[model samples]
Target: MMIKLLAIGKTDSTHLQELISEYEQRLKHYIKFELDIIPDIKNVKNLSEVQQKEKEGEAILKRLQPTDVLVLLDEHGKQHTSIEFSNYLQKKMNAGIKRMVIVIGGPYGFSEEIYQKAQGKLSLSKMTFSHQMVRLFIVEQIYRAFTILKNEPYHHQ
Candidate 1:
């Protein structure tokens, strides 16, 4: 199954982008992985939080395929250990999923429409993180998950 990470805005930190790219490369050895960055909405100063999310949500929806399973990275979502996450992904692969679209929402979070479309939500941590940092964390965890699945010496119990 293909894993697609769709996020809003560009990563301003070159350091973070480099690290995320590293994991993206490593992930290719195990499964198809794509990091698609949606351009940030313009003139956000003029729009309300709801409007911003609606616009971002519209853009996000447009990128998804009819068969794609939508998963949102939400603060209030279910949090799983790295091992548990690997098992979760294993279940999806066994189920013959086509493409899993994981989304990182805008500053104000997702819109009602986006929430309605999502099949599941996952939380990396209870604490908040910058969107850019979250990108790296998710990518690395995915890479680590693959290593764990392969019995590689990357993750420790």
Candidate 2:
């Protein structure tokens, strides 16, 4: 199955961008992976938190296809170990999912409409991280899950 990562804004940190690129390349060896960056909303100083999320949510929803299975990388979502995550990937593949999309929401998080659209939600950690850093974290985890599935030595118990 194809894996798609949709996120708002750009990665400002050069270090994080490089790492994300590395993981993206590694992921290609095992599966089709694409990172689609939705540009940040302009003139955010005037908009309320709810307004911003609504705009962001609209952009996200517009890009989604009817056949895609969306899963949000949310703070309150289900947390899984490396092995379990790998199994989750395998299960999606076994089920013949055409495209698996994982979204990284804005600083204020996703709107109610976005939440309702997702088929599942996953959490990388209980502790908070920057919205920018979460991009790299999810890409790396996707690579790790694939390696674990293939019995590669990338993940350790």
Candidate 3:
């Protein structure tokens, strides 16, 4: 199945972008992977946190297709081990899913509408990381999961 990562805003740090790209390139060997960045909202200084999330949510939802399996990277979501995540991905591929869309919400997190649309939520860790850093983490973990699935030497655990 194709795996897509949708996030709000660009990765501002050149170092982080390079790292994200490295993992993304590694992931291409295993699946059709793409990173979609939803540009940050304009004039957000006037909007409240909730309002910003609502606007971002609208943009996020617009990128989704009805058939795509939407998974949100939420702090309160289910946490999985590396091997377990690989199995979860395997199950989706086995089920013949066309695409698996994982979203990393804006700083204030997801809006209610986005929450309602999601099929599942996954947490990388209890500790919070910058939205940009989360992009790198998730991409690397995805690459690692595929390596684990294929019994490659990339993942040491």
Best-matching candidate per TM-score: 1
In model 1, state the lDDT of residue 79: 96
lDDT of each candidate versus the true structure: 0.96, 0.94, 0.95
**Candidate 3 has what TM-score?**
0.97
Q: TM-score of every model?
A: 0.99, 0.98, 0.97
Candidate 3 lDDT over residue span 1-157, tens digit each: 9999999999999999999999989898999999999999999999999999999999998999999999999999999999999999999999999999999999899999999999999999999899989999999999999999999998886
Ordering by lDDT: 1, 3, 2
Judging by lDDT, tell me the better candidate of 1 and 2. Answer: 1
Clashing pairs in 3: none
For 61-116, candidate 2 gives per-residue lDDT tens digits of 99899999999999899999988999999999999999999999999999999999
Query: What is the lDDT for 101 in model 2?
Result: 94
Kindly provide the TM-score of model 1 when superposed on the true structure, using C-alpha atoms.
0.99
Q: For model 2, what is the alpha-carbon lDDT of residue 94? A: 100
